[model samples]
Target chain A: MVDVQAHLPVLIVTVPLIGGILTIATGRGWKPWAWATFLTGTVFYFTIRLMMQVLASKTGMVSYELGNWPRQWGIEYRVDALNAFILLIVGGVGFITTIYAKLSVEKEIPADRVNFFYAVWVLAITGLLGITVTGDAFNVYVLLEISSLTVYALIAMGKDMHRGALTASLRYLILGSVGASFILLGIGYLMMITGTLNMQDMHDRLMSVPGILESRTVLVAFAFLLAGLGMKMAMFPLHMWLPRAYTYAPSAVSALLAATATKVGVYMAFRFLFTIFGVGFSFGMMPSGLVLLLCASAGILVTGVTAIRQTNLKRMLAYSSVGQLGYIVLGFALANLHGIAGSVAHIFNHAVMKGGMFMALGAVVYRTGRCDIRSVRGLGKQMPLTLAAFTVGGLGLIGFPLTAGFISKWYLVQGCLERPGGWPLAAVVLIGSLLAVVYTWRVVEAAYFQEPDPGTPPVEEAPLMMLIPMWTLIGASIYFGINATFTGHIALTAARSLLGGAP
Target chain B: MTGVLGIYNYWIYVILMMIGLYGVIAKPNLIKQAIALGLFQTGIFLYYISMAVIDGGTAPVWTTVQDGAQKFQGPYDNPLPHVLILTAIVVSVSVLAVALALIINIKRRYGTIEADEIEAMDIADRLAEFHAGAAADAVDEAAAEGHGLEHAHGGHHHG
Candidate 1:
């Protein structure tokens, strides 16, 4: 029984994987089956949390070798403070998104397509969870492709905006596949040099190979991995597919991907740079820190500036998502305990903020049948609760004090200032926050200040089904902000582990 | 430099990768872009396969007649990259198939597969709609401003 319990993390992913296949086999008449599968995923999420607590208490890490194989010889699934924290985020967001999807799917998706959507949703979640939990380097790329492919399908299924969604999904598919290829190539190169695919083994092997630290091949692999993961994470220049995909996707799909998908990619990047490659090999040996810093700084300014000009609420949020990712990257590039902690905290913080905001927007769309800023005028008076959730979420985006966003930005700025000549970087980070305020305030202004058209019909509040989860996430954003000790402790410990110390 | 042919093979993979990347970046058509993505993935596959090849490697499968003794030597091919590439190929094909399906749907709805043209159409529609809204607002403002004077004159005549 203890051994069985030890497999809970893997079970969390595998249950969904098997459920997806079963869902497809049952076809369209299996709504109850779909719900059951989704519920199972929710159960798995809770179990995963329990397992995380146990791991945190016991050995301070969880490692499971697949097929009863030894770690170095076969695939390994390892969860530590770093990944377990991310696993919680992915699973928690995934559970809520699944519940939200149950109601939203019935409205937006055709009856015939609902089953397929649920199947793909489960598969995507499974892939994301796998990516987060797996300790094997190549497995990340495989799981990434699985999630990316399903995401393309899910996005392409949007109602009348099929053209835009299809185009966006295609663009993502092309770019995403190429990115995965680069990752695969980079992993191949790493394996060629290290003779192992296990991340810890690769790290250990990499240390002893003479001149391996200075190998151009290693640098090339690093570049490939960075570019590949950057595209998936929607880092600024590679963010072309983001706006349209987010705007046109079924709102629930948008929420899930915004909350969890790209965050997984970010986690992968962190894992590669900080753990597998090791910080000293990457930051101390190469110019990676500078490269990441430059890209992140540019991403923050460019994407934040661009966000303010978007008229569509979803598009604006998408741009904000890009800017937020830049902040996370910047935190990682700072290359310190504070920096890594801030980045990790932001991972959780941004998810709640973006997820809540998107869910609120989805609620507005549900009530009013439009996502345009003009359409949401006077929504604050009508859908007061949903709009209030949006306000809290928006404030979080602006890094207002007592919101989760502020805590992340505080640490990130502190991280930046820890280095010499870091004040300018800190200023840029502050400017990014100000830009977030501008765009978020734009929505608030439109929602509250603009009067409703006299002839328009009155709208009701979003259904309680949707409002419940939206408020739950909003509450989490505030709750985490106030009692950040729990999250902060995990983040700090995770950062230490990532920086090569055992928790 | 002593092994001249090995260097040439590496360059071929590099050229292939660049070609695929160029096509993906330069092409505007969705289908063409998907093909380009496939080519890029194939380039990686080529690189991996080439890396796996030894001087005189045979196929990886073993025969019972050979007493299951593996022929692992300098002349044997490294099976790892081949295996990895096979999985990569499958993933690439899956992505391609989905991308192509999306393209078909795009063509069905928008009547064009050109990304630029579709974007142009969307922008033009938005601009036209924006102009119409501005025109409506102008008329509404003019009507509101005149209605005050009409109301004032009617009230005075009635008094």
Candidate 2:
């Protein structure tokens, strides 16, 4: 029999896929919720087990070859410290969000589709987790398609909330399918040159062969991959679909997606640049780093200002997420150890902070039946625990000292300063966060300072079931803020792994 | 003549793909956009299928001794692209299905399949919401326990 650890790699993905079918089988009411929660919890347990084993190993990578097939022909799952860190985010966020999904989902979706929602939610998580764990080139494309398809279904479930949800889902489906197709075509081009689908194998083979990097096919692949992934992650200009998709999706689904989906795009961009293309050649061949830098800077400036003007809370948060994504890309473009490490840290921090904000907003929507900023007036008095959780998340977004956002922006600026003539980029960073303050203040001011409408009736706080998950994420963001050594140490280790062979 | 004929597979795929892109971006009707998406996807499928072709190769299937055939010695067309295309085809079909389902919902809710008209409706809805929110704020101030509330007068001032 295969070693138990070897099974962990496949199990992390399979359990969720199987759980999804069983989730659908259980059908409506409490059964689907219970099934999905239990299944996601089990997946979380498996991910921790595999990650601990990888962390303890000297190599910091866990690889499993599928079906005992030959190396080049078979599919492989190779999880390094880089992806291991992502695994924890996906699993931890998946489990925590599932905990809060029941009440929020029941309110937002039609009764008949509740079970279907959970099934599709689990499927989307499976696709995301699969993308993280796989070590094959083509497999990433397949999993991307899988996740994109399921996400469209989940977003469409929010049609009951607004008719706009239907159009949003349609736009996302169209763009997402095109993006996935481009990635597939890029993978085809890579396969033509490398003759192997396995990522690690391709890396080694590409390095050994000289002059291949200069070929027209490789350049074409690079462009296609970057543009395709850029569109998926809502990179700077190509981010038109993102705000509406998040604004209109069921709160729980959007929380999970905003926490993980685009982050997976960030991961692919890193993998392609650092691992597949070999960092030296990728930056040297094309001024990719400079291009990314300018693009990311534009996203931060434009989206940050736009977020200040949104009256709908969810739409504002969606625009803010686009800005946050810009920060992660900026870290990569800086191409320093600290910069990449900061990006990794922000991945975890953003998942918690953003997820916390969306979850709290969902709780607000649950009670009041509205998502407009006016609905939140005097919410601080009515829902102290929920608003307090949101306050912490909002402060984190503004990068106040002693929060996760500060730590991320700190290292990212430090990464910039270390580069020659980098002060200008650092100024851009400060400018983005300054605009963040204005937008975050809008929500806090509305919730705490403004008076509640007299026509509105008294309201109770959100149920304990929702508060617990929301508080957990808020708490984690703070904990990371205080004790950086935990996420910080892992981030450094992962960054080092991607940057080189020796620490 | 040979040069032109050899690359025609690529030429057709490119033309179909552009046509599909036009349908998706330029078409106003939602159903038309969905059909365009299908056309775009079919172009990609053909592109992949063309990549699998070989000048003088047979099918990749292997023969058993009982079959008494030895065609395996010849160059076989690449089976991997074909396999990949099959998966892509499945993904594309499912996406199209979801798109159609969404269009039906849009038609029911918005009462129109034209993109511009739906956007116009959304803008109108938002204006109503803005006024409603303004009215709510005025009313809230008037209703609060302690005051005549200067803003309370503004509620009836919407005219």
Error of 2 at A182 (Å): 1.2
Pairs in clash, predicted candidate 2:
A454-B140
Alpha carbon deviation, residue A341, candidate 1 (Å): 0.5
Q: Which tens-of-lDDT digit does each residue in B1-159 have in candidate 1?
A: 447674676788888888888988898887778787878878788888888776667776644555776654335687877777778889988988887888887787778989899778666645643443333333454442345323422221110
Poorly placed runs, candidate 2 (over 4 Å): A1-3, A501-503, B1-5, B63-71, B139-159
Q: Which candidate is the best by DockQ?
A: 2
TM-score of the second chain for every model? 0.69, 0.79
Worst 10-residue lDDT window, candidate 1 chain A: A32-41
Can you write out model 1's per-residue Cα lDDT over A1-503, one digit (the tens) per residue?
45656677678777788877667656564473456446555645655665456555667777778889998777898878888888888888888877666666776777777778888888888899889889898888888888998999888877343345666777778878877887888898888778789888888777767788688778888888888888888887787888878987988989998999889989998888878788897788878899888888998999899899876788889989988998998998888989889999999999998999999988887776556676677888998998899999999988999999989998999999998898888998999999998998887887899886443457999888898888878899999999899789988888888787332
lDDT values of the candidates?
A: 0.80, 0.85
The lDDT, on a scale of 0 to 1, for candidate 2 is: 0.85
- How high is each candidate's TM-score? 0.92, 0.95
Q: Can you tell me which runs of candidate 1 are displaced by over 4 Å?
A: A1-3, A25-40, A43-47, A50-58, A501-503, B64-75, B125-159
